[model samples]
Target: MDGNATIGHGPDRHPAAWNPARTREEKEEQGRRKEERSPMPPVTIMELLEKCKEKTALCDAREAAHRIKNDGDLVLIDVREPGEFEENPVPGAVNIPRGFLEFKICETCPEDHAPILLHCRTGGRAVLAAKTLAEMGYRNVAAYQGTVDELLAALE
Candidate 1:
């Protein structure tokens, strides 16, 4: 469909004030009302990171390596960019960037009970990813609470 196409009539059709006939003042007022009705309070990134850390399981790089060595079914995920994963790839980890984790996880490990470990450049992204996976119904999930370098060092 064309981005500029509009197909319908009545107030319902022009609902979000996309009618183009509405005054700028009316649009601004609508925006203000929307903001006022927001249910969630603003949260800083640091606060969110801490909350994720608390909600998710976290382990050190050495612990992650130990688990991978012992648990053959464990899925190790390097939650970094493609370039980063290419530059310093973990021996057995699959590259799944944090942004695409949700979309691609089912393909990689469909079993909710399968052990999964996530790591990134720093612990922050891994913690967030671990929290997300847990919310997505993954029963066994853990984040490496250290940098990729640290994880690599531990693997050795």
Candidate 2:
């Protein structure tokens, strides 16, 4: 884990390199080859965010609040940092930072089939969190692209 630490068995452990012993020139060549081999990703985070958002079940602020209020099987997750949650927490949401969501989701809600609604400061992180949960075999998931505060504000 040092500055020059490589993983497999070579000098280049920068994560993208396949062979560690390859020199810089060789590594650059290898990287180019890898790029040619694999398809490229979206140009920006917005594109990825859009994709994640499209793959999920969406709920506006009202629907999300209603679901949390009435659905016993629903779990509302606030994917914000501790400081953000403490400032003005979502009514029924459990604070789980986006970084730890993949690791902590199962422990927080073991019922895979139950609906889990995810939201963050804005819409982007919720889509991402929902996507991650879906990828991890969660059956029922929803992403409130609008934050809980947005919903509450509309009510007022």
Candidate 3:
């Protein structure tokens, strides 16, 4: 259809028609309807990173290892594959690989609100995992950046 032509089927609809006699209340109502239909702004990667940092729950691999060794309260979740975890993992870390994390963590963990420290081969997968966990209402979650090897070296 042409830009100036009305497309919808109704007596009240007119594409090129503008009601100059609309009252202030009517204008306000139309503005409200338009605002309600507008899409929300997209969240960027930088925003996510900053949020993770501000939450105070995010930690590096070395810090996570220390927490697991001393605090013993946080859940150490290795988001790497089973094969990778079998080769080596941080001491006392549970193997809930990235693919199965959503299912396994929610099922097995006793407390939905418990603090969890997640790590993958590197930081990338852990960030994604942490985001997922946070979205699922796990308030206290952290992502460990370093891989198993780096963690082990730091421990030594």
Candidate 4:
């Protein structure tokens, strides 16, 4: 036997395995299986923000305060530290730091779908808090991406 010769039968012995028709069908089947197993596409921040805008789900601290003053059911959540909240908050805002927001939001706002307006020193922590709330099944949540100084100035 030559060095390159087939070991057992012959080089073309597995004819069915190399058939183009079978290969195509196998590939299509694999693609179908993959499609079936693919997870739902993750929601993007822009989409979430857009939804917030559509539902009137987001507001700045001043807007939230005005709404609260005008018999709105919006819950103003300060996702910063207690010291920061004490330093300055939108009049009636509750101090629920970002770390404990997921656990405490339900207790503070019993309704699973209640509208929540969240704010921090800047927008970063508030966005994280809003995302956490959204993940926890809170349908109406928004982040105020402005600093305390900006909020105070706006209020004035």
Arranged by TM-score, best first: 1, 2, 3, 4
- Report the C-alpha lDDT of model 2 over 52-142, residue by residue, as the tens digit: 7778899898887788778997898989899988997877789899999988987899988988988888878888988999898898999
Instruction: Estimate every model's Cα lDDT from 0 to 1.
Output: 0.89, 0.82, 0.77, 0.74
Q: After superposition, how far is residue 87 of candidate 3 from its true place, in Å?
A: 1.3
The local distance difference test score of model 3 is 0.77
Q: Which stretches of candidate 2 lie over 4 Å from their true place?
A: 1-28, 154-156
Best by TM-score: 1
Task: Please list all clashing residue pairs in model 4, or write none if there are none.
Answer: none
Highest lDDT: give the candidate number.
1
How do the residues 30-149 of candidate 1 rate in per-residue lDDT, one tens digit apiece?
999999999987899999999998888889988988997889999999999999999989889999999999999999999999999999998888999999999999999999988878
- Evaluated against the true structure, the overall lDDT of model 2 is 0.82
Error of 3 at 21 (Å): 46
TM-score of each: 0.77, 0.75, 0.62, 0.58
Model 3: per-residue Cα lDDT over 7-103, one tens digit each: 4578877565555566666899999998889897667887776666565456765687687778757787888888888888677789998898888
**Worst lDDT 10-window in candidate 3:** 14-23
For model 2, what is the alpha-carbon lDDT of residue 23? 79
Cα lDDT of model 1 overall?
Answer: 0.89
| Candidate 1 Cα outliers beyond 4 Å, as residue runs | 1-24
Error of 2 at 50 (Å): 1.2
